[model samples]
Target: MSITLYALDGCPFCVKVHDALEANEIEYETVWTEAMHSDRNEVKRVSGQRGVPVLVDEDRGVTMAESEKILEYIDQTLAQ
Candidate 1:
């Protein structure tokens, strides 16, 4: 399964999500929203909003916004 996290460097929520993923030992690619302007637009297009800590699970075909929910979903899905 491939997981990707879209975030900005200085966002507190983004940091929380990153820490959560690390704590859970979940492997994922981090896409910095500020650095990837084009991809950021794509994320907004798909999610219908511009938000930090957007998590995409490619294998499950799930994309979600919000840090707390993403953490919970990851924990539930990846915790075995």
Candidate 2:
């Protein structure tokens, strides 16, 4: 399973999602949104919104936004 996260530094929601992933011991690759101005294009293309803390779980075919919902979904999926 490949999990990728689009996030920016100093974003509280991003930090929340990251902490949840860490607590679950889930490994993921981060695409830093603050890296450059042009880098946000990828996030916009993937999610249709210019937001941080977007996550793509390739194996599950899930692309998610929002920290609370993403955390709940991950916990439920992991439980199952």
Backbone clash count for every predicted candidate, in the order shown: 0, 0
The lDDT, on a scale of 0 to 1, for candidate 1 is 0.82
User: For candidate 2, what is the TM-score?
Assistant: 0.87
Write one digit per residue (lDDT tens) for candidate 2, span 1-80: 69999999989999988888888888889988965556689898888877778989999889988888888877987423
**Candidate 2 local accuracy as lDDT?**
0.84
Give stretches of model 1 more than 4 Å off. Answer: 35-39
What value does the lDDT take at residue 71 in candidate 1?
77
TM-scores for candidates 1 onward, in order: 0.83, 0.87
Worst 10 residues of 2 by lDDT: 71-80
Q: After superposition, how far is residue 80 of candidate 1 from its true place, in Å?
A: 3.4
Error of 1 at 15 (Å): 0.8
Clashing pairs in 2: none
> In model 2, where do residues sit more than 4 Å from their true spots?
35-39
